[model samples]
Target: MLAALATFGTSILSALVPFVNLEVYLGVLATRIGDDAAAALTCAAAAGLGTVVGKLVWYWLAARSMQSQWVAKKLSKESWKRTFDRWHTTLAGRPWLTAAVLLAASIAGVPPLLVMSLVAGALRVRLEVFVPTVAVGRAVRAWLILAGVGAVLT
Candidate 1:
């Protein structure tokens, strides 16, 4: 449990920091946690969660800051609106859809930041969707990383 927390805390940190090279940082963390299979999964999951949280902050800002000059120049209001629509659809159309997408992306080695941010932004997911989708995906991802580590170590 403590390991989970520590690993999760790492996720939060990664989320909070901008432009964290997740693979490098996660690789180092995996080494520290243990080169075992399960440990790798744990580390990945934690980082994934952090990345999601971080993107969520951005997504939230995107929702409110649609009129900012930076937002206008960088991203379109139409795009932002589309994202909210998608997120809402995910919530209404299928409650588990977001979580599944998140988990699959994690297992496939997609940068959680990229995948989560885009999806979350496009979807304009609520805080409710944000929490569980990220949490569950992290749990599964952490397991996968650890399994790989065990395979290599053993």
Candidate 2:
């Protein structure tokens, strides 16, 4: 339980601080735990939930900032507002596509989950959709990484 909490804490830090590198921490943990698959899985679960919680901070911040007078003034440009509108419309129109992209970003880090979180919030993705996709995607990613490390060590 303590280890799981530590994993969760580390994951949250990694989410907030890009240089923290949760993968490196997870790899080190995998080596220490050796073949303890249960422990590795537990850590993965914690990491998944923690990452979502941490990323949610970014989401919330972006969402709130968008409503600010300063942000509204900055976005007063017609071109910028048009771009934002196009993206918002596209995302809103294709919910499944947004979810798929979120999942891919969370797992593969192709688009970078941090950026995606901000984008989702700026575009106003529902919490009901954002949380689950991110959680499941991150969990799968952590599990795969831990499994690979265990396999290599064994």
Off by over 4 Å in 2: 77-83
Candidate 1 clash total? Answer: 15
Per-residue error (Å), model 1, residue 30? 4.9
Writing each residue's lDDT as its tens digit, candidate 2 over 22-124 gives 9998888888778888988898999999999999999999999998997798689888788778768778868898999899999999789998898899988
Runs of candidate 1 exceeding 4 Å displacement:
1-5, 18-52, 73-97, 109-112
Clashing pairs in 2: none
| lDDT tens per residue, model 1, 109-133 | 4535455655565456566766666
The TM-score that candidate 1 achieves is 0.59
| Total backbone collisions for each predicted model | 15, 0
